[model samples]
Target: MKQQTKTSKNPWVWIPTLYFAEGIPYVIVMTVSVIMYKRFGLSNTDIALYTSWLYLPWVIKPFWSPFVDILKTKRWWIVLMQLFIGAGLAGIALTLPTPFYFKASLAFFWLLAFSSATHDIAADGFYMLALDDSQQSFFVGIRSTFYRLAMITGQGLLIILAGALEIMTGSDPMYVNVTTSPTEQVDYNFENIPEDLSNIDELTFVVYPKNVTINTNKISTDSLSSLKEFAREHNTKNGFIALSETEKLKKNRLDGGETWWSHNISTPLANAIVKNFGVKKEVITKTTDDKVGNAKLVAVRLNKQPEEDKEIVLNTGFAKGDKSISIGSGERLVFNSMNWNVPAYILVQLDPKLEGVTSASFKGISGNIPLAWSITFFIMAGFFILIFVYHRFVLPRPASDHGSAANSPSDILHEFGITFVSFFKKRGIFIAILFMLLYRLGEALLVKLSSPFLLDIKEFGGLGLTTGEVGFVYGTVGVISLTVGGILGGIAVNKKGLKYWLWPMVLAITLPNLAYLYLSTYMPESMILINTAVALEQFGYGFGFTAYMMYMIYFSEGKHKTAHYAICTGFMALGMMLPGMVAGWIQELIGYQHFFILVILCAIPTFLVIPFLKVDPDFGKKDK
Candidate 1:
């Protein structure tokens, strides 16, 4: 009767929201932040480096768990930390648009990371305090389900929304008209107009349109420029013009005149004139502006002229026989102007002496992606706001004893030292620590680079998946498989015990990495193929991770069982952080294909350490 009375209240009210809150900040700080930084134009090295530092709060959290236990009631810590996390999120949104946004926002993320880690300690402790053993067991799956839902919201819906918003904020393509001033006949002569441009004696006098995208947004211009430079360095500058040789030749034949030679010009510039200016005849004389706006005659050249021979007699116009337009056999005609004129003609005076040099390139206008990113921050801030309000009113505040275990600063330091020393003193402690560190070495490197490889352009040896596609494939499909695998792993370990399943779990975790290697090698464009591959890798990770958790539980047996488990988790976090910090730099150096091959090689350490580690035959089994 007494036990039934104690558990009379419904468990549904708080468990779902409690676990959901716990998951949001973690996903935000860890996974969402990685994607956000990539879209913000940070180098992979910087993204991996700084974001890895955010894990410090979790790595050293064991040192602070004792403080949460002794200093206040668990309910107090949970509520207070939620509010703190909420404020930190708002701060991130506020700092995103500032000049020092990277440094400023990282500082706020640090605050959120620390608060979230402390909240984990409080939330777990409170779970034990608030419910009886039966109630706790019944609600475990419910809490897990809600937690995964939060992961979907953070990783899937949020990312998809941001991607959609990016399209909304995208700048329209800017059009600039390019024209040549010297429309009249020049001094140079070429009687043999070769059908094939490759046969041209001296390909001279080229006029092509280059898209000069000037980002009017003050906040993102610098980052975009840096990204452009990085892209150029990596050789992913979006491939040259969008015209085929046949199209150019067909247009030249249809036009038929002085401007017919324009077909031999670069594809991008010629295509733009045809599409934008709508020049029906080869000569563009007195045609309506149509889509053509103000023109800039930036430069014109008959051919490469010697420094001494190069002349700019701009005082005279192209009226009949002007000395300003000098098109000699050896002398290259040159002109420069920043003015617009009606019915602009792109006249090319080809000299047989020159090698027929004509080329121009066009690039799409780069958009302000940060505008969308900044809006994402604000949206997250609002999400935290709703969480704060709900938790403030609805969450039950359980009563408990609040006492300070350490009265002074020295006492606190001494407690921390003792806690560290006790873990190190356990039997087989060194080997156990090595097993924990090496178990997921390959996974740590692979997770950090996964998003980057997906987002990179196909030309750069990446999958070139869009943000929404990546969100769906990895966040929706991959996470679903991971959860299913974890559930099955638990059932398998419970039936046969950890010792029997240890080696199989290790293989499950390490072998699926080959999927990533294959994807990078083939560079598959089909979404179905990419999603299938990602799902395989994630399912393996989820299933294999169960053994790692079971080992920690097995090793944490003793007088200070809870404290030992916390210490074990710290080592797990360290394993992820250390390798992740350098993963990006390595990927950047060797590229994705070789980098994944290297990831497969890292599996050796994982397998090598497993044989030496001890596990109890009946560790995870229930006594019937």
Candidate 2:
């Protein structure tokens, strides 16, 4: 009564589900983990550098793929890898509450990444063996559709679910309303200063002068000088990384293993890249004029001591209204028993062009980050367990699903070595590798930093979007628009050819970088505006990306095409990884605005390499 006798062996019953399962772990390892790390309290630099390395599994998956043939039946590998994936998810969930959660969870993610990469190899192999040639063609699109659905589920629905849980598990959100008027500023004076609230025992925001006025045009030298001095003197400590935590990070990062190499070698190289190619350092000049933006102070303090074990992390940003009025600093804040009563100041500033009277509310939410993410991963783990069980029974037993005829592991390695050598020895292989690596340089730089940009507070130059809002922007709308763009791009390429569409596709991908540049420069408060910007950028990326994919298919057309294509993907991932590792480090040095500007500049390399690429006139054309 507890178990059913048999499950259906129909391709309908398994192809979609198997591919869906395959996509889930890939998306989780590649994209979802970046968002999870952000919500879990990792600095962007660490998140990008570490997660980009996760690509190592996929980058080298081609190297080990043939081994999947010798080790076990593709069916066996599929079921076993699903089980391993479930174990990885469970491991992450379990370690999330521990003191060294970051390191421990990353280890589990590696397990997930490796298992998923193997699963990709096995699942794709099984598809061919299980179905007839005609059936394979019929289900190819179906498998891709389900795979994409898996991406949306992992990125969109899963993220929204986590965000909701974060709210449900935390305290009621707090909102602080502030206003700026051109006529309401007071001159520099001791009388305007507020009382010290350090002795008071209470948890509340101490927003002084609900209506703040400043001179947008010009201000007296003495008054400007006084406010600047005060802001410098009372600067709030960073909310995300404390001095102690930062030192610990440096120590841990440099201690040993791969990190030792990263700290000494990769870190310096990345810094060098940033220094040479990133935004120029500021050069101060003597001037009779003053800074156009004016600043004011707002404070937050705890009324009572918090529980010793709990750390309250408060992230603040503009809720709505004029974008010109913004928090210049103190976007992220942390308070605990040790600093319960002392007031932390947030510096507010007005854009020099902000004219007339306008009002805006800055909202802050303090959530229990670890618990929220812990629950998310635990649920995923449980879901994977169910998937493992279902696949164990449901997947069809194909005739071709068997280990290699050769008995020796050495034989398998030898064949793999041949495939690798053949791939490397292809004509114009160097050019092909360079094209794969450089094609998406700008996107590589942008992808690793986008989540951090969306999630960071307004004071730090992010859009101040919530997790759900961000999920909606990228996971939902971005994906949908991307699909449409890809479909359109395919149609256009089919009508003409890859050679004809190459420049347009490249432009489509590279030009939309300006959307991000515009958003960061203006820092708009509207969610709709943010969504539109992201959609435009993603759509362009999807359209332009058609060329990159076509080029890969084109390049992989010779003997050992399938294996060569896999190697091409490895090179593609390497391209993304190298640029991504440095993205966050550079973004932190320069703000988002300049970071995006540099991203736009990266397109020059893409264009520079274009003349070297050769594609047949009829490559993607239907007539071919």
Candidate 3:
């Protein structure tokens, strides 16, 4: 009997895992990181800006894809890049808890991103090398299904897991409360105080001269004293006291009470403390003396802790008669109060901008990520380890002229040049590239901001969904709808041909975006409504995107078809990157409702450009 070739090994064992591996890091780097940054309290602008840059490798992967075929065997590149990806993921986990995590994690993310892109090239090339054309066509659907399952794993399950971890590991911030003793007659003063209060331990009160003007433009102390008196008399009657700075003005109230001024007084007080004392400052006040007999200064101090410590101390001054605040160990008080109202407490995040005062908590919106992150990373690393092992042992190598490409770099460079030149030489190539970019413009913008919109407050025109809910809607329900739509689209195209189905596919993609418009407009909290809308939109996107993809394949039918298709995808990435980078900024500018409307308007180009493109009448028909 003839010896069995390694290439004869079952494609089933490797194809699923190969595509699954290909997808996880891409989703993590692209979509998951966006959600992570949002939770980390990064502004939408920054989240869009930094995370959008991660698409760079994919956008330029075609340039390097030719080299993967030239340099080493596809199997070698796939396994090696997978190893690098695993290491990069572990690196992200290691750096997540550090003070410089944003920088460090992003660096690792960049590494993982590049490696994942290379793996795409290698794994895809390897698939072609190992399988005959018939097998290639046969396993395509299996590979795609597995790839999408990876999407649900990363986008849905991992997100839900992270959200659950957040709830499980999350703790309420420890606030420092200042309570007044009925017997003690505490005097009020605001004068020169040391900037660095981190050294002071226990309750140490620093009294300043009462009614002495803050004497600087930074803080109008005269106005603040008047506001304090006004708040004591008005209580909850004044609307300004109940609103945040942004809300107060929008309510159309003519009275600019002390409540309005005092709500924003913390920033100036912080500035004054920083300027005069050369240290960071926190301003916690009792604007309303409601239940508290009289306003008194109760000074609480912060003890010195290790530099790496992440304990948060809030200087929260509440009015008298409120419940006592509780805190965890390692947490110290700087001051305390009960029944605290808006403008009543001004807690400034002081930056001691000095060498001795490194104790300021950098606790952002998400505060600190739970220790559970390490576990999540380890699990990911384990998955990669298993993948690496399976591929090394079970995968068969393909015979090729690998040594020729490996030895001669110049030949690879020459082929890349020819590949680029020949791609543009195709008929209607300009229009083909135009359609590639425009077809998905609206979808590109939508994908970038969709998660942010879901997590945003309903008042801001978003769905106000939790991270886990978003994962559920997008990952499970939405992805399934997408897959079903894609399958149906393929079947339909096979029966009627792409030309006959083109318009319907276009409608499928563009019209479903209105689901977002409806959600943004209505701001429904119901999961059923949200899921249905998301599923509908995703199904449309999947169906429409099939046409876009098929058109690329159809357009890239001549010589150098592979390289030309790669170039087309490069434009596709570019289309997503350019809009995604700006979508958040645009959403921030226009709010979610208008942003969704804008997305709908963006689809106009897709409709307008259909006439300019060429499609084979029987391209996708079975008889063809």
Q: Kindly give the stretch of ten consecutive residues in candidate 2 with the minimal lDDT sum.
A: 238-247
Residues 1-624, model 3: lDDT tens digits: 323245578888889999999999999999888887665545576688778888889899898887787676788888899899889888988887666778998999999999999999888878887787788889999999899999999889988887766655543323333332323333444233334545555322222221111111122334344444454334223221222222333343456443645546633443343344331221323223211112222222222232343422222221222222111111112111221111222222111111121112212112234354555676787889888878888877666414344457676777778988888888888888778888998988898888988876433345556668888988899889998999989998999999999999999999999999899877665679989999999999989888988898898888788888888888889888888887776666556777788899988998888988789898999999
Better of 1 and 3 by lDDT: 3
Cα RMSD to the true fold for all candidates = 18.2, 5.4, 13.1
Q: What TM-score does each of the candidates earn?
A: 0.70, 0.85, 0.71
Worst ten in a row by lDDT for model 1:
324-333
* Arranged by lDDT, best first: 2, 3, 1
C-alpha positional error of residue 44 in candidate 3 after TM-score superposition, expressed in Å: 1.0
What does candidate 1 score on TM? 0.70
Alpha carbon deviation, residue 121, candidate 3 (Å) = 0.9
Off by over 4 Å in 1: 1-9, 173-367, 405-417
Residue 237 of model 3 has an lDDT of 38
Question: Alpha-carbon error at 36 in model 2, in Å?
Answer: 2.4
Looking at candidate 3, what is the lDDT of residue 525? 56
